[model samples]
Target: MKPRSVRTSVTLAGGVAAVAVALAGCGDTKAGDTTSGSSKVTASPEAPGETGGSGNPTGKATPDTVPGHGKTGQTGGTAARCTAGELRAGWQRQPWSKDGHVFATLILTNRSGRPCTLAAGWATFGKGSSGRYQELRTTRAAMPGAGTTITLKPGTSAFEGVKYDATQGCPTIGGFGVKVHAGWNDVPGGSGPVVLCPDSFTAGTIQPTMNGVNFHS
Candidate 1:
């Protein structure tokens, strides 16, 4: 097994970014996010100062069969299926984030000895507490080519670009979580709390994290 390398990243204002992990041999080894759906799910408006586990309309609850969980379109790869244990998760703030909209990338690395595949769909996730994405996050995909299975070789990585916003005078998030397989893993997002009122939040499709790829906003 390769040694787990420590990665570091630029901190967002207010220490929203916690103690970070760096990419080992990859460029900078920052955080990442994931997206899904054949088409994008528009976010619904929530009341101001509203806070609860009540996810967005397009968002699903945990233990998701949402899109890529068990669907043939999302997981038809011949490579060994990736389990939650074999992958490590992290998140990164997008360089283009601005104007109340916070974009991020979700990253999952294969730490096992063998190569495997990831479900080519929206990641099931939520913001609140560590490893407790009780609510599933929403995702939109680039269709006609979205469900192409992603193979993760040992030490390689996959990513999802997630979209969210921070409302002024709202609550703060404890952290974030996402599901690869088996169960939910933490994907720390500093996108603040409260999915209310004009706050849009949804992930983009899963893709191979290379050449500094990003899920477009």
Candidate 2:
């Protein structure tokens, strides 16, 4: 009788151990789920077409966020990308632009009544002219200070050099469009997109200064 009692007690203890192991397994699974949920908090947004701020398409890596001061290896304060709603555009022809090539500086102003950053690798478009609002096909040119973090304070401006062919039978327009890491906005002010011809145009890099370019990415 005593031996039988001891066997029963041992059996009960084994069952309790098995139950503990099962509970631990369930706990591990729950912990894994919690970790995954935490990661989602910091994940990047998945956007399509065009780019986010800092010139990379949304849903992908963009410099600074180009809000994160991204992997461009360029370091700066983590500033949010400037939005189209906050920006206004305009242009001025460069003094040295010749007869064949129309060289001009594309100016982007921060009209948001606040400060923002325009990441590198911005895109520019020509406004359609002659009772039209067409986006012209403009090319990009390689130049000094083309790709750099441009900090635009309230009422401040960023500049880009544009070179297009005037002799190529390009059409006239009332304004130009500027696209940075964000969407396109009409830069309509003064003479409007004079350097912008609908057919052939080339845009240079953006810089904080109108005269000199920065060579860093």
Question: On residues 75-187, what C-alpha lDDT tens digit does candidate 2 reach at each position?
Answer: 23356656666665543433334455544444556667666666554343435332233334444443542355656666776655544565435554454333433243432
**Least well predicted 10-residue stretch by lDDT in candidate 2:** 3-12
For candidate 1, report its TM-score.
0.57
RMSD of 1: 13.7
How many pairs collide in each candidate, listed in order? 21, 9
Give per-residue CA lDDT, model 1, range 1-217, as digits (tens).
Answer: 2312222221222224321222221121112322222333543222112101112212221121111111111234468667666666645555445554555555667767887776444454444544443343343433212434677777776655555665454445544444443454333333333332232555444556422334334
Inter-residue clash pairs, candidate 2: 63-66, 64-67, 64-68, 64-69, 64-70, 65-68, 89-187, 145-214, 146-205
TM-score of 2: 0.50
Q: Least accurate stretch of 10 residues (summed lDDT) in model 1?
A: 64-73
What does the lDDT come to for candidate 2?
0.36
Candidate 1 has an lDDT of: 0.42
